[model samples]
Structure formats: structure tokens, C-alpha cells
Target: MFIFKLLVILTLGYWIMMLGDTLWARKLMRQLPASPKPGGSASTESFASAGLAQPRGTTAKELPLVSVIIAAKEEEASITETVKHLLNQTYPRFEIIAVNDRSQDGTGHKLEELRKWSQGKRQVEVPLTIIHVTTLPAGWLGKNHALYQGFLQARGQVILFTDADVLFQPHALADAVHYMKETEADHLTLTPKIVVNSFWLSAFVQYFFFALSLYIRPWRANIDSQHKHGMGVGAFNMITRQAYDRIGTHQAFAFRPDDDLQLGMRVKQAGLRQRLASGRTQLAVEWYKSLREAVQGLEKNIFSGFQYRVLPAAAGVIGQLLLFFFPFVAIFVLDGWVFWSYVLSIVLMLSVYSLLIQSLIGKIGKELLVFPATVCLLSYIVTRSVWLTLRQGGIHWRGTFYVLEQLKKMKR
Candidate 1:
């Protein structure tokens, strides 16, 4: 009985701490300036005045060369579409370097087809280099190693590292470059609109982002600020040659599974300016196909992404539960004045969550009805994360086993 009371006290304490942190973070987000629009007047002027000449009225300029590097492994289904999207970019001076990372399927043949198509259509004026890495290097993650090899073969002034599943909008490259120049940012990362068709999948993505926004406002804060911490989806990130060199590129985070987050941290540590752009307008990525895939996908990085620090991650999960389920739980679990108190807390939490979701949905032109479902969806993800941490050793992704023991070893 004594132990049970102690456990309850600890849980309640954790809940309060999480709530306080969320409120503080939301307050900070409110105080920050709004995120800049893609290819806006200010962005264009900033880039143009920074020595990169802007294309004259839709006639795209002969801008500095850009190499779009895509690292793929067994991505036969989506590789063709990704390649086609890159080839169709409105930007004139750019090349596509698709690294086939030991794909056992038709990924290699598809790349050859893309090459043949580009040659026939005269779609590619710049060089296109496709390198196949036969073996994985030591102390390096597969994606990072593939990207590093791509970098070695690239001759572009800007190197854009993207995943094989991403479909780019025609103007994405041009707009991204303009924004990079305007912001004087060394690294530019964006959160792509994760496409989800299944009921559970949609809920997972929605709640994930909603909970994230409450704690970390990636879009509003500068990358180098200590108070700023956000996930940089590596699916769509652009880095200048100079900035890449300054931060030592992928080699700096070779062993880290969550290379994007590690790279961002390194950039911050090096005191370089980075910006998070809105990819909701220009980029889309399908994260997973099914619920099991989604669960495994998130598991691989959830623990490691937190640097194997369980306390904060645990607290984060609990906070999310309180924020999302507190209202529903309160109406049934409490009585009299206590019930009303819980009701007010729920109202406050829901109101804040709803406002954030509505604003984001309006900005992206997505359906507003998906907002309420975010709570239910997030609750599942949080629960799954906890279960994965306790029951399973780790998460699986792309046939690789990332266990907690391995993560702890990597930390050393």
C-alpha cells in the first residue's frame, strides 16, 4: 500500500511537470514571430541581394548547380515516381544523384529507365550520377553513408539530401534555394506533409505533430537557440556546400540512427544559422503503409532520438496523455467539485490543441475535422512508444534491428 501511494505521487508529479513545460513552451511559441512564407517577397529579395541572381519573371536563371541526392534501399515501388518528380523540376541548373544502396529489387533497373527517359526527353541538362554502394561502411548508418558517397560525386554548389519516398513539387527546389539565401541559413530543413490514408495512420501523424507543436515549435524558433529543439525530417533538407563543409557533413553523425536530429544538433553546436521551412506547401512523403510499419518505424528512433534518456521521453508521453485524454477521463473518473476542476483543465487543453490544429490546417488547406481525432491518435502513439520501450528490446526498420543495448553502446 505504501509503494502504491508512492507510485501515484510520482505519476502525479510527472504529470504536473509535463503540464508546466507544455504551457511554458506554448507561451514561448506565442511570443515568437510567425514563420516566413515560401518564396515570399522578403525571401526573394534576401536571396537575390546575397549575390545569387533571381530568375527574371518565370524565365528561371542559370542559377548555381544543385545536386539532388536520394538514398534508396529496396524502394522499387516509389523510386520511379520520385525520379520523375525530380526530372520535372522547374529549376534549370540541377542534377539528380540517386544512390542505390544494395537494393535487391527493381530499384536499379528503374534508375536506368529514368536515365534513359531523361536522355530521350532532353530533361536533364546537368550531370546525373548514380552510384551503387556494394557494402556498408563501418561505424556509419546506411542512409548517411549513401549520402556521403553521393556528396563525393556531386559538383553542385548546394546539396539536397532527400529520401526515396518524397515527391517534390516543380517549384520546390527554386523556392527552397531562394529561402535559404534570404534567411542566410546554413542548413534548411522542412517538415513534409506526411500522407496517410488509413484511419490509424492519419490519427498517428496528426497527433504526433500536434503534441510536438505544444512542446517544440520547430517552425517559429531559430535552430541555434538552446530553447529550440525540433525534429528535422531528412526526407527534405537542403545544405549549401560551404555549410556542409563547415559541419563536416554526414561523417559527423555517421553512427547515429537519427542522423537528421544529430546533424541539426551539430549545426547548432557549431553556431551556424539554420531554418525550418514549410514543406506542407511544396513537399509530400508517405511515411508508412500500415499500423505495424508505423509502429516499428517510430520505435527505431523514439528512444535513440531522445539520446537514450528515458526520463524526459517518459514524461513527454505522460504529458501527452493528460493533454489529450484528461477531459474524457475527468468526466467519468472524478466527482463533484473535483470533476468540475478536471473539466476546466480539459477545456483549457482542448482549446489550445484545437487552435493550433486549426491554424496549421488553414495554412496547409487540409481538412479541419481531423483535429479532434488527433487526441485519440496521439494517445495510441504514446502508448505504443511506452510498450516498445518496456516489452520489445527496440524497433525494427528496413530489416535492421536497433536495440536498446546497441543504442547504449553507441552513446559511449
Candidate 2:
């Protein structure tokens, strides 16, 4: 009972911290410039007046070629929509490089169809290069290898690396370029708006984004250089070619599961500016189908983040239980003011979670009020993930079995 109380108290404290962080982030975002879509009501002069003009060193006549590269492996479910959205982007003088990494589905065929159809009736051609990566090198991860191939093929002043599932708005690329130029950022990553179609997906997404928001706190990424860390989202990483050349591109992050993060970190460590922002309304991605799928997908990231250490992974499970689940368990064991206080904390927790969810995704159902239950659910998922990783001896991502020992060494 004492332990439970302590847990509840700790959770409440964490929530208070998260609340402050959220408010600060909101304030920072409000101060930042908003990138208007081309043909929108906001004129170029208005953007300049709003302090959201194009990069200081460049004009419309000298716009650089931006290459958008996607690495796909068995992403047939959403690749079409993703590629189509890229084709619809308002950003001019850009090319799409979609690499199909030995897909078992029709992803390659779909890319071919889009490329050919767009090329057949275009004035200056669709400018989409569909590369087929049939061989995965002995030591490289499939996705990383495909990305390296795309990087080798790209010939642009800017590179946009993204996932095959992410859908960009008509002005997504345009806005990103503008932001990059304005900040003179070598690397800029925008967190996508997660769209959930099912109840379970919504719950999982809530937990995921809440954890990410608490951890990342995007607002402070550029401001706090003392921490000296940076993050990149696969949905949107706009990197100048100079930074890529300086940091060795995907080769710098090859064989790592968290390629985006490591890449961003490398850019910052190299004294290159790395900016982060929310693409809440400008971009969207349905990350996973269900909690099970999410857990399956999280194997690499969890272990990689933990440096393949079983002890730390187990501790994470314990932390999740205490931080998220204990308040509910405390109810049955306590009484009077103590219990009521715990209940109040629970209300605070749920309210914070609901607000975060509403802002990040959409509305939540009454069924989701049982927020503490999700903690217990996530505890199980995380525990199972650790056990599965140890049992299988490593992570099996995209038909490749990466050994645990090797993953641990990757930390160095």
C-alpha cells in the first residue's frame, strides 16, 4: 500500500512536469512562423510580414532542387497513397526517388505504374525514379540499405527522407523547405500527425505519442544546446545536401534501428543546425494496425534504445507499472482522503492524457477513460517485447534476423 501511494504520488509529480512542458511547447510553437501553402489565401508578402518568408539567401528564381527519397519494403498497404501525395506536392523543382526493397507485394509494380503513367503524358516528365533493391548486403539492414541506395542516386541540393506510409499535404514539402531555409537548418524533422482508424490503434497511439511528447519535448530541441541531442522523424527529415555530405549520409547510421534519431544527432554533433517542429496538420501517417502490431514493430527500437540490455528493459517495465498503473491498483487498497487524493490524481492523469490525445490525434471515446488500464496493457506489451527479443535471440525486422549481440555492439 505504501508502495502504491508512492507510485501515485510519483505519477502525479510526473504529470505536473508534463503539463508545464506542454504549455511551454505550446508557447514556443505560437512564436514560430507558419508556412503557408502555395495558392493559399496568405500571400508571399503576408508570409514575409509574418516573418515566414523564404530562406534569406535565396529567391524564387534560384529555388534549389529537392529530392524526396522513400525506402519501402512490403509497404504495399500505404505506399500508393504516400507516393500520390508526393506527386501532388506543390513544391516545384523536386524529384521523387522511391526504392522498392524486394517487396513481396505489389509495391514495385505500383511504383512502376505511377512512374510510367506520370512520365507518359508529362511535359517535363514526372521525374520519379523507381529503383529496385534486390540484394540486401550481408551486414546491412534492409531499410538502411535501400535508403543508402536512394542517397547514392539522389542529385539534389536538399534531401527529404521519409517513410512509405507517410502522406504529405499539398504544401508539406513547400513548408518544410521554407522552414529549412529560414532557420538555415542543415536538418529539420517534423513529427507527423498520427491518424488512428480503430479503438485499439487510438489507445496505442495515445500512449505512444504521450510518451514521445514527454520524452522529445520538440520545443526545446533547438533552444537547449547544453543537452546536445537531436531527433529526426522518418515521416519528415528535410536535410540539406551539405549536411548529408558532412555527416556521411545513411552510411553514418547503417545497421542501426533508430536511423532517424542517430542521423539527427550526428548532424548536431557535427555543429550543423538541426530543427524540429510539429507537422500536426500538415502531414499524417497510420503507424500501425493494432497494439500487437505496434509491439511487434517496437522490438528493434526498444532493444536498440536500451542497448540490448535485459536489465534496463526489465526496469522500463517496472517504471511503466509504477508510473502508469499503480494509481488504479491503489484504489482497491486505500480508503478515505488518501484514496480520494489518488482518485484526484487519476483524474488529473486522464485529463492530461485526453488533452494530449485530442491535440495529437482526435477525440477519445468514454471507454478510454479507463486510462490506467492502458498502463497495465502497455506493461504487458513491453514485457512481452523484451521476452520475445531475448527468446528469439534478436529482432526479426523485414525478413532479416539481426542478432542481439550485434545490436548491443551497435551502441558503441
Per-residue lDDT of model 2, residues 100-210, tens digit only: 998989999988988877877654343899999998886677888898899889988999999999988777877777778777888888877787677766776678667
Highest-lDDT candidate: 2
Q: lDDT of all the models against the reference?
A: 0.67, 0.75
Per-model root-mean-square deviation over C-alphas: 5.8, 3.8
Over 39-68, each residue of candidate 1 has an lDDT whose tens digit, in order, gives 435535543433334643432344667899
Error of 1 at 340 (Å): 2.6
TM-score of each: 0.79, 0.87
lDDT score, candidate 2: 0.75
The positional error of residue 68 in candidate 2, measured at the CA in angstroms, is: 0.3
Question: Where does candidate 2 stray beyond 4 Å?
Answer: 1-9, 29-61, 299-301, 362-367
Model 1: lDDT equals: 0.67
How high is the lDDT of residue 328 in model 1?
A: 64
Which regions of candidate 1 deviate over 4 angstroms? 1-62, 223-231, 359-395, 402-404
- Poorest 10 consecutive residues of model 2 by lDDT? 37-46
